[model samples]
Target: MEWDIAKKDFKRYLLLERNLSNHSIDAYLNDVQKLEAYCSFKKTALAQVDARFIQQFLVFINDFSISAFTQARLLSGLRTFFAFLQIEYDRKDNPTELVESPRLNRKIPTVLNIEEIDALIAAIDLSTLEGMRNKTILEVLYGCGLRVSELVTLKVSNLYLDVEFVKVEGKGSKERLIPIGHHAIKYLKIYLEEVRPHVPVQMGHEDVVFLNRRGKQLTRVMVFLIIKDLAKKIGLTKPISPHTFRHSFASHLVEGGADLRAVQDMLGHESITTTEIYTHIDKDYLQSVITQYHPRS
Candidate 1:
């Protein structure tokens, strides 16, 4: 088979046969595509390519203004692609086995302090209809620490108010039960009972948990807009987005002594290592810790 044919089969296997999640498959394919693009940039094709070509691809990617993390992931993707070729294509040898990911220094995510989160939440007026929707959006986003896609795709049917939990279909269609705080649950109930009913329902989006006035599913862009506007109204100087709330959620939990593994499970992280960055400490917090615990203090 041609190189493209085998590549296509590998993608299908990752998706249908292996039941890999779309996000995972996308990462792998994007890596392969980046390699292809790098080659095209140099006027070469995959069939004639080998390890030296991949090393060059890595160096080329590094030369750009990219993070070590991004470069490392790209290297991983290319490595997997070549390995797949060796096994499925019956190649002579695996060419990418020696490739190394760039070394990375872990950085903690920025988060809104509890007071700041409270201020942001307080800034929302419960009296207005838009206020109601925005309030519910904020609660659920931070309360569950969900990615924007998961939050927007949340449905009315997944809500289990009696159990104080909501079902979320996370990365790879993996389902997790996230506890909904009573405060958030109260607002969500308000949105469901009072607000969602008034919005004009778009045909297929009837089940969507968050909707625009048109009752269509809230786009990622809309969620971003909501967060930006809310932050602006509250005069929050830090960069905030729908995802920021998730980071804040995880950070706050970690700071409160929630176990990292437990937070990972709630966040639907496949690996604990991926969730460990939430434990990153800021300079101010470190100073406070030193003063509180040191006998010299």
Candidate 2:
């Protein structure tokens, strides 16, 4: 099969069968395209490629000094692609099946303490309309443990404030209901009732929860910039982004003895292993306490 045909079929499978998000589909397609380019350089056909060719492609990418994490992600995408070809085209073998992914060290995410979170919120100038809206944004981010994409696309219709839950569309378009905190509900009500109505609602953005001054839905970059500005305002030296709030939300819950499965559900993680990283954070915190306060030196 031609590379282009294989890629098109793979994309269709990802969308129709796997239900992956557009961002994820694009990443998978990009990985296949990279392999296609490498094959073109080596005068190889997609149908003729084998496990040895796949290993050679890995060597080529590794020569560029890409990080092991990125290499592993690329290999994962290729594995999915070849598996698709194997199922649909009745291929005799999948080249990526024999290839092993690069070993990676999982990095622990940075988290904000309760005092720092409070200070970040306090640093907002609530006298202005934008300040109130920004405050609500931060509250929902920390309170809901939402991804930046989820936060930006949040809709007014999905917020069940009376029941204290917000419906979130996570990866693969899977929806989950996250319990909203009272503080988030309070600020969200203020923003929706007092601040949002005052702004001119754009035609298509009427249902959007957060808006820019121009009456359009807020972008992911806008949320990141807001968090960066807040971190700077509070003089926080830790490099933080919108994801820091999510990490803090999960880590704090785990430290407070919240169940792992419950935290996993709230965070919309498909696997408990992904959520278990917060337990490591909790252990690190305990180790710090022991190192600092324990008298048995």
Candidate 3:
């Protein structure tokens, strides 16, 4: 019942039984680590920890001023862990079962308008090899609405340029084929034909679609930095990351009257509700159309 052993077993359960992705498993383990740290600070053992101990840990985390969404996610992780302990280990009780998550505000995601997206891309030099790769990266990110991790892990074999679709290995290793736009395909062809061929491929990364200067797979951090630099270069006031293009992609599609289910499939969202957020982002467009065309308006 030691914290270390408990975390290891929980991770195994998540991997083997739940079949969660590494990103999700890491998040759950991070929550457990937080609890373990709190327990250490209080000189308490896992076996002796109770609901009160969990509540105290919440208070400790609250002092750090994390967002409500983050707090809720952490609590969800803790609840899952304690439930696993109760069911699998035959623990008498679950400490986090009754613990409530923080009330979450529906914060709208930041989305770039078509003009902003264009401006960002237009700012790229496209003269150097890295610039060409960066342009392709932005094009694919916006065109396919890919997650940063998916973009990094994208392989050459998965691309079906003839059919204009790329097989994306999404969350939980789920595979979905997303149609690539003409612009994305055009830039990808240029990068592949003109730039990427010049770089020597590393041993294990021969098939990786994007690579670092060293001929290795590009890291997620590298992608973030690239986007950050571009945003700064263009004097974009709103903070943005790689995910901004994804949000923008969905928003623009919804505004253009794309079906929610179709957008959901494209984005690899397991739930329609996650895709529904794009509808909210398109509310202004919906209202404008109604106001102009509807007799009642």
Which candidate gets the maximum TM-score versus the true structure? 2
lDDT (Cα, tens digit) per residue for candidate 2, span 1-80: 78778888899999999999999999999999999999999999989999999999999999999999999999999888
Point to the candidate with the largest lDDT.
2
**Residue 27 deviation, candidate 2, in Å?**
1.2
lDDT (Cα, 0-100) at 157 in candidate 1: 95
Candidate 1 minimal-lDDT segment of 10 residues: 1-10
**Global fold similarity of model 2 (TM-score):** 0.93
Tens-place lDDT digits, model 3, residues 1-297: 777778889999999998889999999999889888888989998878888888888888989998888889998998899889988788999888777888977778999999999999988998889999999999999999999999999999999999999998888888999999999999999998999998888999999999888899999999999988888999999889999999999998998889999999999898899898888746676799999999999
lDDT of all predictions: 0.84, 0.92, 0.91
Local error of candidate 3 at residue 246 (angstroms): 0.9
Q: What's model 3's lDDT at 203?
A: 98
Ranking 1 against 3 by TM-score, winner: 1
**Clashing residue pairs in candidate 2 (N, C-alpha, C atoms within 3 angstroms):** none
- The TM-scores of all predictions, comma-separated, are 0.88, 0.93, 0.82
The sequence of per-residue lDDT tens digits that candidate 1 reaches over residues 1-297 is 455686688798788766788889988888877777777789886777877887887788778888888887777777777777877777776667777678888765668888888888888888888889998898889898999999999988999999999999987787899988898899899889998889999899988999888779989998898788778988999988888999999988987899998999899988899898888766798899989999997
Which residue runs of candidate 2 sit more than 4 Å off their true CA positions? Answer: 282-295
Error of 1 at 188 (Å): 0.9
TM-score of 3: 0.82
